[model samples]
Target: MDDDLRERIETAAEKHALLNAVKHESDADVGAIMGPLMGENPDFRQHGGEIPGLIGPVVAEVNGLSNAEKRNRLEDLAPEELAEMEAEEEADDSLLPDLPNVEAYDEVRMRAAPNPNGPWHLGHARMPAVIGTYKEMYDGSFIVRFDDTDPETKRPDLTAYEAILDDIDYLGFEPDDVIRASDRVETYYDHARDLIEMGGAYTCSCSGEDFSNLKNNGKPCPHRDKDAETTLDEFEAMVAGEYSSGEMVLRVKTDIEHKNPALRDWVAFRMIDTPHPREEAESYRAWPMLDFQSGIDDHLTGVTHIIRGIDLQDSAKRQQFVYDYFGWDYPEVVHWGHVQVDAYDVKMSTSSIKELIDAGELDDWDDPRAPTIKSLRRRGIRGQAIVDAMVGLGTSTSNVDLSMSTIYANNRDLVDDETDRYFLVRDGESFAVEGGPDTAHPPLHPSFEDRGARDIPVGDAVRLESGDVPAEGDRVWLKGFGCVRRESDTLVHTGDDLDVVREGDVDVIHWVPTEGVQVRMRTMDGDVTGVAEPDFGDVSEDELIQFERVGFVRVDDRDDDETVVYFAHK
Candidate 1:
């Protein structure tokens, strides 16, 4: 087999296999490469992409594919298409629309508000990232509301508000202003009063158990017969703390015989004994239920559109009911399927992440192992990479985990050439050069103009890797410096003469001249001892580099003489 024919066959086989694994790409892509190769080399044979009259199917253009990749795509097509391969390639942009026709508005004048009982997590970030991205595209305003009326379970820290705000800012989302449920308490009371007057909502004196059982089968409470005047008085008493906690509850009067039990007579407000973190020990004991708060807020804000998870699909039905009672316009709601963590094969939940953190298995909320935005950022995963991984997954009604780290791996590979390389030494292992012949030090990333050649003087006593140091007559690589047939591990490079070397690696290890400054680094896994790359003192926090053969690294902190860094997971 001649070199040209052998090369073409290998390339064709690899392309064919990659297409098999790349579920997103079609076979026609393989023909682009094979056409040129088979035409140039007579010995090569092609399978797909040569049918007489069949035209090539159009495929969406995925971002980040190189021209060479585009060529490889041709080989996967039918053989007939190769003969008529002169068809022009028109770029596909269906995945992301130009959206010129979307009417832009400045502010949401609309309804469901954020659940602010906890800080934003990866799941919480999804809608906001999409909405915020769209919001910015149209210069629109989004309200950041604190759904704090449900004080049934309050965070220990009163500053839960600030923590949520901080997380939102960290993710770069800019809301128009802060909206709190407490601020609307009087507004809710007035609306509840009006609903009672209209007989659309009723004050229920039923116990928690009775209230739940009431939805199972329609039955009117003795208090349900009270006139609007009496119901308003009772609601005022409940708000005024005249009634003890849970003594009276307010229920929206949906159809009592509704088939969906969840849609029937849902509680609109209840009294909770627990003191709110924000409100402190005030005697105001009544609290608005989540459904009522969210529904009314979205309506009041004039939110024209709604996007939430499928798990919250019930929210749409319930919110629609609220609109029906008030005769208000219902907003357009678009729900997305669930996002799951590929490794766990379960929906990524903040509670699970917190559980891991609480167990001490993960370093912090932002630890790369936790899969939070901070964690991904710490891992050197760019925001755009996360967004891209999400965007291409075809949206379906069914829930599935689309996350795959390999997408980030593929992205990182494209930018590898631009990454600087550094030699990092492991503990119990280090290299020494026979110091005699070298002249001056070369740069860590050698320039292409100078190639990789160094001007260091010739040395006979130069050291080989401690591992590759020959037992007696083993050969080893001197790395970019060159290969050397090692005679012994003890050969230290003294500043004197040139030593000849050849390649034979048991394993290539790292080295630094005995005289340079010694530095210590902390990797994500553990502490490692390595010669710091020269620019380690000069590089900014955002800069990342490949630590030679070890892994990718980014310097996170510089403490006096010590450096703290994070290593990429293998």
Candidate 2:
């Protein structure tokens, strides 16, 4: 091969090697870079035999530099390639399939009806993410409805009404309308009375055990044949607080011998003497069950589509009987199976998490250990990441086992370009370094040098985590500063040329000056104390940042005494 051809081959190999190294954070593979190198430079394919020999040294040189240096060199050598790589890494927000029969409806109105028992967890984000996506796709309205009617069992929390809305907003959705079922008790009562007069519902006074035995045998109770007037009177009496709790329950008439016995004569309304948490429903004792209330509200509010879990298929079956009685068309229903996240060993139950909080095991809804949406947001997870992760699951009915790494990957893409880099040595140990530069200039973000560099002042002594300290007689690179050789108790300055350290295979590590600012990072494992670069103090609260070689974190609190951050992911 001629000299010009060899130079072009080496240049192509170095570009691909630098890009691959920056991506994997490891040595570039000669095999992986070869295909892209030849593909991009078709002229080199004729000399494929000589290409590997010429490119091998170039790949080795590219792999020898630290991750930061690899990125810096890539930005300097082939900035357009770096930009193309980033564009490919950007999160694709169009993962969800189009809603079925979207053209059938004039407006695609949908609702996310979450029971306001507690704040929303990660599991609860799917409904809103899905519904919001459809709403945007069709230019329709999204309703935030609180299904908070069971005042006794799943008692409503007054504070959770706003908390749930706040979570929905954080997930990048704005409710076109907000409805509290507790405030609409009278509307449900009107529907209950109409259904009773229509001979579709009856008041059942059978004891719990007796009804269970009769229903198990596919036999009707004595009250099943009662006239509509008598049943309505009894229901009115129950609503008037004339009967104690569990004495009478309004049942929607259905087939007693249905294959799924749970669908037989399902309860519609029941008497609960326990006062509701909200004042609007405090005077009422009779409340509708979830299926009954949601069925009526869905139709009354003009909901054209329903998206829910497959486990609730029976809800659609039961509500169909009521829809038939009213001569109303049931909305289009889409069901998805349960999604299990591998990271959360704890049950993703609001009641269970509330128990933990009350027992003093968890700090609150925003605790780093909890799976609540607030916890995720507080841990530096972006709303867009959560939305994309949930929507990417699609509307398939098959149960999915997801890993948190999927979420972290999506989050890393969303945060990488914006978050500035800093150094934080956790459980740091001080070490003397003699004759180093007075100031070190590291790019705020290696990909975007236009953002400028952080002028971190260096001193004669520096600190690194205990595990990062080099053994005696070992040489290491003090990132962005210079190379040093550990001699006895101190690291003695050697040279500033990166090629020397790269050629010697010395480790490149991050460090903070002896007078660095204190930082306490809260991670899922536990709290870690450390020191960070002084420029870390300039970061505003809630800003996402990366600790040089450490993981990404969100600043929670910063003060002169101590700076607190939450570890997001590596």
Candidate 3:
């Protein structure tokens, strides 16, 4: 809005037009052009908060110019000047913060430990991005460890483990190593044995209610004073099928008088006869609790930094006891509060979503309605957009509530420039165009004409969405073409001039040939069957594109006959 900013944008816009010309492109991409301009101008960087607001006006300004005027302006700048400006603007800053204790470690290491009980949601996706950022920042290693220990309650599905790994890989943050906790049951048992032998853990036979009462009263259970040798024997018997479920638990020794009763003699290992999907099966009867296992794994795997939700801060406290007992330093822990995405009404809990999925009430994890990372990926939400959204919120302790618009806006900025525009007519109605051209060549991208155009045949009639058709006698512009007047199921071409249509209050409509590729647009709301440009049929699966006047969509499944795309957003 500032005069200086306007001048800067004008200069950049001219250079953009010229560059597109050099590359033989059809148009300039406003979003693409603004990214560098914003990066180069400190003022733009300071004021350019969100992508939507930051580049919206500059795009409008550039788009307002005539093709002739744009070409004339492009001639103002020399090639060397444009190159220098591009070089100045192309330097991008790292989007995340510095690691807390980078100086203390020779090789920084982090891990995104996911309990593979169900498909990953957006919340779970945050781990890898934050961990991956630290890895990049410190030039370290990232481990994707599956903490699938609780087979009874939070049971691990073998399919989910692979799905999780696939999701992480899709995020562009490939783990240096992958670990399954179920396969390391013996390692946990070894740690349990060490704790028992060191008199840091005891076998408790107290009922759930009795243990709670003792914990609440800050009193140690009768089993707490038992000799380490005796407790070790009980632990061995428990693992050897001598103890029934809930009959005995291995509790790590902590101060009985600790203020938080939950932390006082918390259960380290418990008996669960339910078989693990990956390993041990029915052979292993005891499994370490999350905190116990995570604590041990963190140390054993050499994790130097751990970032997780604030709800698990107590887990850190309990894990510290184990670390203290072993005379080992706990990793630097950073706890952030919950982030509430307003778009999803459901719980977004993996266990809950899994139940619905198993019941056939929902589709797979990639169902658009679900908030899983799989859904986001399928819906054309970029991984970097997700990371940007998460990191923008930062590692804070306060709860943050936000709309999906923030993420959608980020995604829009990411895909807008690259996404080619196409015409789609939902529930189409045919209308013959009198005096219209035999073919229409609309730029694939409005700003970046160098990308070329989609050749759409005029045919006998063009298909327009039922809502897009103008009433008889009303004038409208069939975008990329010129103004036309409707006359009872027929469009009479007024002129091939855009200025006439722009000067008049004519409605702009997107249209496709009546005989084009059939498309089934799968949206979050519902399915919309439409006819798209024939070229859209060739769009590869997972390609992100814009259906002009409709919305952005990702090609989900495609064949020669029909194309299926997931509608991302308008």
**Which pairs of residues have clashing backbones in candidate 3?**
25-449, 25-450, 26-449, 26-450, 27-447, 27-448, 27-449, 27-450, 28-447, 28-448
For 411-486, candidate 2 gives per-residue lDDT tens digits of 8888999999999988777878788778999889999989999977877788887888988888888887889999
What C-alpha lDDT, on a 0 to 100 scale, does residue 190 get in candidate 3? 93
Q: Whose lDDT is higher: candidate 1's or candidate 2's? A: 2
Better of 1 and 2 by TM-score: 2
What is the TM-score (0 to 1) of candidate 3? 0.82
Give the candidate number with the greatest TM-score.
2
| Candidate 1 similarity to native, TM-score | 0.73
**True lDDT of residue 307, candidate 2:** 92
Model 3 Cα lDDT, one tens digit per residue, 1-570: 556555655565556545554333345565566665655544545545554454456556555666665555554665434333332222132256566877898888999988888778888767787787778777899998898888888888778888988888877788899998888888999999999989999999999999999899998899999999999999999889788789999999999999888889999999987777665555788888999999999999999988888888899999999999999999988888888777775577987888778888668888888888898899998987777666666677788664466567667778889999998989888988898788888899998989998888888889888887788898888877778899998899887576544333576788988889889988777688989987787678989999998889999987767888998877
Task: Evaluate model 2: give its TM-score.
Answer: 0.86
The candidate scoring highest on lDDT is: 2
Model 3, residue 553: C-alpha shift (Å) = 1.5
User: Which 10-residue span in candidate 2 carries the lowest summed lDDT?
Assistant: 85-94
Stretches > 4 Å off in candidate 1 = 1-113, 137-139, 154-163, 169-172, 279-283, 343-347, 355-361, 393-395, 404-419, 435-480, 490-531, 540-542, 568-570
Overall local distance difference test of candidate 3 = 0.80
lDDT of each residue in 1-570, candidate 1, tens digit only: 345434445554444433332433444353454455455434444333341111122222322354456445544443223211311111121143323324653443322255555444555555555555556656666667777776556433455567666655655676776788777888888888878888877888888788677668776555666788888888898888877787888888777778788888778878887766675434557877877877787777767676666777777787677778789876666666876656432236656766777788767766655556665566565555454444443344577564444334434644456666555444433334443335434445644434342333333333222444455554344344443433354444322212322111133444443333234544444456655533445556756766665667666766566566666532
Q: Any idea what lDDT model 1 has?
A: 0.56
